[model samples]
Target: MCKGLATLPATCLKSAKDIKHKISFLLQKPEPQAADQKQMKEKTAAAAAAAAKRVPTAAEVEKWKESFSHVMNSETGRTVFTSFLKSEFSEENIDFWLACEDYKKSTTSKLTTRAKQIYQQYVEADSPNEVNLDAATREETRQNVENACPSCFNEAQKMIYILMEKDSYRRFLNSKLIQDLSQTHSDTAQMKKKKNNCDCTENRQALAGGA
Candidate 1:
């Protein structure tokens, strides 16, 4: 009877241990699920990275380069083209043509205004010796010509004009250009030396001038 009783308790203990082990295993199963989730996330991220690495087509780059080359070559043509770009035209090519039209209109207006002013001055002249009206008008005309010349304008406007002429071309220079240009590793020692030299010269000049 004693042996039977002892065997019953031992069997119960073994059953309880087996149940505990099964419960522990069930609890630990979520760990593998978490690992699997992490692995899946890693795989997904890798795939996305690979997709992002896809290079732009060679043909697209070539087309852009060709358009840029065209704009850089022509000055007057580019300028007239860019003015249209700043306007309401959707197509770049059309915008360039529109810019040309606008330029023509502006030029005509300026010429007409200048001519009328000159004619009025000539009619109102008090004497032939009192500054020949024609000579004064000629000088005025020359000055106007200098101001209206393309060389007198800013380079940005010139670039814009080129972009306007060729729809495929675009001038991307801006603050970004400055940032890119400034990214070089500068020599601090050289800069300091230049600054010291400039300061020294300024001080000597100030001393010599009694300032």
Candidate 2:
């Protein structure tokens, strides 16, 4: 039977090798055409041009500076600022702050370290809850507990819940701080406009009285 099978398989062996070679040939990627290369170069040039055109205006810089100053100076602003430092600012920016001769490096380092630690804690704690473990028998018990009572999933579940709560609270505080700052700036602008209008009205009245 083995001799008969080997003798009967020459055609099948050739067909299989042909199919394998065809698959290999199909899988070989084609190099980019000259037109594709030209198009990529044009795209790169256009992006560079667009980037070069984007210069910051003096007014925009001043507005940012004012907002930064307000946030850094006031107590509520300080809290918001710290949160922003924790959430928005990049490590490079944080490093720049730490590098400032006037600012204490230890304080900046502590804030940056704390923010990173919290962020890591939040990510680690949140990820486990999101993982789909339906295929795992061990996780079936966890799934059952989750279904029965989400509050009963042990330490990992509790940690995730606490982290989520902390994140939500931080987000709320950040939003409120932003709203307050926006309102304060808007009020200041309105008051200035009102004062200017009053001055103009007074000047016009005095001119009419003199006339």
Candidate 3:
């Protein structure tokens, strides 16, 4: 049998080099077309515009600054907070919070699938994007997720939320960015008030002149 295998025709056997070359060929990606490149650029610009449009109003910022929960619950608050967190490389805190929010809403049928995904993405050790969790909490989360419980990550989520609340939230309130925005908002309001007063004064003068 060994001799028969060895004597098989040359066309019947692939050499090591040929197998490697085949794999390399199969893995090669095609170059993107000019149209695809243009589409990508347009998509990126649109996404940037959308993010800018989501900037919170001054009142909204003040509201969020009052409560950590408010910031987490509000989309505009989350966007602005996440931007600050990103600058500090701690955006994972809000990322985990949002993921937990979405995970909690998963339908029963999708619970297992979504739980596993969240665990691997944000809870698993050695995961690139894993969030901070104590060993005990991490172990508990691992066990809970094994059964796909709706609240599998509740403990871990709360830890991250508290971390952000105590740390990032304070920094956000005091940051130069927030201060500048607050000042700008005040200036804008003052300008609007002045414009309204000027318009009223002009109307009164016009009536007096007519009289």
Alpha-carbon runs more than 4 Å astray in model 3: 1-54
List, residue by residue over 17-128, the lDDT tens digit for candidate 2.
4433432332222333344233433543343333323222324323434544433333333333333433432222222222221112225334343333322222222531
* Model 3 TM-score, all chains together: 0.70
Better of 2 and 3 by TM-score: 3
lDDT by residue for model 3 (27-134), tens: 222333444233433543343335445335778768877898887777556656666776677766766677677668778997887777778767899765689889
At residue 149, candidate 3 shows an lDDT of 72
**Model 2: how far is 109 from its true place, Å?**
18
Give per-residue CA lDDT, model 1, range 101-197, as digits (tens).
Answer: 3333345446444333322322224521122224444455345444553222123224434444343334432222212222211222334455667
Please give the TM-score that candidate 1 achieves against the real structure: 0.17
Model 2, residue 124: distance off in Å is 13
lDDT: the better of candidates 1 and 3 = 3
Taking all chains together, each candidate's TM-score versus the true structure is: 0.17, 0.27, 0.70
Q: Predictions ranked by lDDT, top down?
A: 3, 2, 1
lDDT to native, each model:
0.35, 0.36, 0.66
